[model samples]
Target: MASEPGFLPRDGLDRLIEVLRRDGREVIGPRVRDGAIVYAPIATAADLPTGVRDAQSPGAYALNAASSAERQFAWANGPQALKPLVFSPRERLWTSWHAPANGLHFGAAAHTTRPTAVIGVRACDLAALDLQDRHFLREPYADPAYRARRESLFLVAVHCTHPADTCFCVSTGDGPEAAKGFDLALHEIDAGFVVTSGSNAGAEVLASLPLAVPAEAQRDEARAGVAAAAAAQTRRLPARDLRPALLARIEDPHWQVVAERCLSCGNCTAVCPTCFCNAEIEEPVSDGSVSEHFRQWDSCFTAGHSRLHGIVVRADTLARYRQWLIHKLATWHDQYGRSGCVGCGRCIAWCPVGIDLTAEVAVLCDDGEGVAP
Candidate 1:
């Protein structure tokens, strides 16, 4: 059974970690590392990025230490999201060997998965996870490896109280507050966390924690914080459904302008949680007796991505950039019934040359042609 909203004091966080670990789940959370906040194995509440806030803008990201020690999830988000956890960046698919007596032999690759409990998950990440699940675990062709990892996971979401300038999850209707797809959700307040369970497993875990009914004041503060976070965002897509307008601008002059600045380095796709392009590669042994097939993350920005019959379809940066933009904003709606962007703003913050997709959409849809109201 799901439990009512409750309050867990600051010290209770450590106990939560202990309980998850005792349940045989490896707890992963945000931590300050390499001058930026990144997710890693966390043992206690002390391992969280306490009093640390991130400053993010187009093409830039930096972490600053705040004066207060009470807030742990004070920042909006980091470059990494839940994509890599379920859809691995690289994994072996299968291996083949040749024997003189047996001719050829093939063996499926073993996928090892461990039960994981991740803390500090954001609403945007949960939304992205849903999209990935649709792509990988949908229909009759579900990916076996992704399914194994996905099933062995537990999600703990944190409501966003501090949004970066690039954030626009409110416009996408995916964030500021977690609405679904979490086992447990938390709103970090000054004194402690206002926690709620969304699943029976989360309720069982909450029962183990020392919790108290959240005061009216704490609940009001949490609501106000999320509202303030929503109001603080300065960037937004021109419309929630950008399919018609974007598809119509396939030959627009703006493609040239964007391509001039785009390095075709694939950084945006790499950091984007919803972008799931990958390439299969074959690795051969020294004796040529064994060959291993591996699947690794790929991006449309690469020169070889659109190659066909020794011909590069998207030969230049303009076509490549246009393909990426159109696919992410337009064609994805045809395939997934929604835009690929989750409004996490990682593509905007992690781009080396500061390309803002929201700004691009505004310019492309400036005439208000075919834009949804």
Candidate 2:
């Protein structure tokens, strides 16, 4: 029946990397760089950040050497998510040229991308992927480029047994455990990893590796680890769906309070896993022959984002902040059938003012109660 999950010795991770590479996929994993954990190209298992930990709080992030050698992928998500890889924050779309003899010539830019096997994916990001798929693929006008990249991805989600304080995936119904949207889900423990395959691709990789059927006791330990993590979380969005209340309070005074602290730097949208806004621009070559069209990420906080016939709809920071929060928590559900937030807490952690969304929502709704982590 293939119901039993398998086990991989801690050292067998190298073999897993080799299997993916042999399948012609580049491996990307979190590595310690520039004083924080960031996703980068990895070859061998040694490239992964071992004995590393990070402390993340509102408006702050710090990385340090882990005291325990067993905690390699224990840290929370880095600045990057699957969005940049698939949706692409900035990318060349096409090019145009003017020929002296002719009127103009347009050349469709050939975009080349690699198939990737992303390791250390957590549950929240997986839920974000679901949102992105709906936004980029299921829409009437599908993004072919995003679809190509998304289709080529081989996901390996890591069950987060060590969530950060910024994480609120539990409230968002996203994480602490990755039950879906993965080729494989791994639970890392002292001796090794308890692994489960969710797809044929994952099964093929599992079949190639040297693995053992996990004992019932080992499986229980893995379950306990994830449960303990869920218990350790201190922050969460309240279960009372904020969408209805948030939508009704668009003009609430709380917007002005948060706007006062907000720099409007767009850090929240930039770090948000579900924020997929982008702007297209054209750049002319110095020689005046070729013009390149590019797509770059944009934010609603920007003044020009809401421009309407030379007049900005959201002229003030208050309006902009209101638009962002409302879209994220309320209107996004009406548009996408789900909240725009996956509760990764990147927005809270990266915001310059440390403006926690939960705190802001609580203030607006005047509801102090939240789901206990």
Candidate 3:
């Protein structure tokens, strides 16, 4: 019987990267790039998104200089999650030339598992994976690539100590602390971290590290740190029972309020770790003989996302908007036994129209009209 496992603070969690690198795993983490935090492969601990914070609101995001001189990990999530590595933005399916005997081609050519480690995964992203696991891994038709990447990867979730103004994971019921699904969960405590292993795999990794057992007081501080993060959340979406609220008002007029300014740019879906609609295209690689087809990320905001035949299912912006929100808060439960929104607030920050799903939920939860007009 596997039970919860805890580890004491070490010299620095930055050393954990050295441990992973020794095992030949390529570590991808958030790094400061072009005035924003972006996830990329890093060789050292210094590349993390340190000191800088992100100022976010609906339809807006700007980098704020580090609050204190030594703050490296102070920031909200960036414009991207760690999705592109797994569900690439574009991938060719297969290509074939004008030859009958060329044989049919297959998409996503063979690739080796690199044993990658996502070092600085946020609580929201981890929650989104919980939803995605049901859709892509637990479903009848499991996605092989997603399963392979998910199974092979090592997850290190960082609990929020400081949150962005736009952050509302608590509203969607997922974050500020890593509740589950981590090889190692980290709570940044000044120079070191409070590390806990949530699974057997996590404990295996923990056993190899040279660390210290936290005193009872430090354990209490760790718990307080997690609680402080939840308390620091400024924006909140406080709806729990969604079945009665959202499914009841599928055709409400509030959809129009948000759709009016929607540019359909698809930034919301791109940033949303849980929005997993995709499309595939075939293209030639080098030879017309050997062609490849690629599965690329798609979005609900795109006109093609709802295309059935020559007609689109949700034609009007209002209908599309309603479909998105309903799928997020209501029907997703039917499909995956959970709400689609993890409350990461990336959608709120990325929405060019500044449409907030929490605000939308508040409208419906209170007035039964969905988003307010």
Q: Could you report the Cα RMSD, in angstroms, for every candidate shown?
A: 2.2, 1.9, 3.2
State the lDDT of candidate 1 residue by residue for 1-373, as single tens digits: 4568999998899999988886579999999999888889998899999999899998999988764667999998998999999999999999999999979999999989999999999999999999999999997999999999999888899999988878988878899899998999999889989999999889888989999999999999989889999988878776557888888888899989999999999999999999999999999999999999999999999978888899999999999999998999889988999999889999999999999888888888774422123
C-alpha positional error of residue 236 in candidate 1 after TM-score superposition, expressed in Å: 0.3
In candidate 1, list every pair of residues with a backbone clash. Answer: none
**Candidate 3 residues 175-237, lDDT tens each?**
878788778887666546667787777677777676676666666766787787677776666
Candidate 2 segments exceeding 4 Å error:
1-3, 99-102, 286-289, 370-373
Q: Which ten residues in a row have the lowest lDDT in candidate 3?
A: 1-10
**Which candidate do you rate higher for TM-score, 2 or 3?**
2
For residues 164-257, write the lDDT of model 2, one tens digit per residue: 7888888888988987889988998877899888888888888888999888888998999889888888777767667889878877777888
Q: What alpha-carbon RMSD in Å does predicted model 3 have with respect to the real structure?
A: 3.2
**Highest lDDT against the true fold, candidate:** 1
User: How does residue 124 of candidate 2 score in lDDT?
Assistant: 91
Using TM-score as the yardstick, the better of models 1 and 3 is 1
- The parts of candidate 3 lying over 4 Å away from their true place are 1-11, 93-108, 284-291, 367-373
Sequence-dependent TM-score of model 3: 0.88
TM-scores, in order shown?
0.97, 0.95, 0.88
Ranked candidates (lDDT, high to low):
1, 2, 3
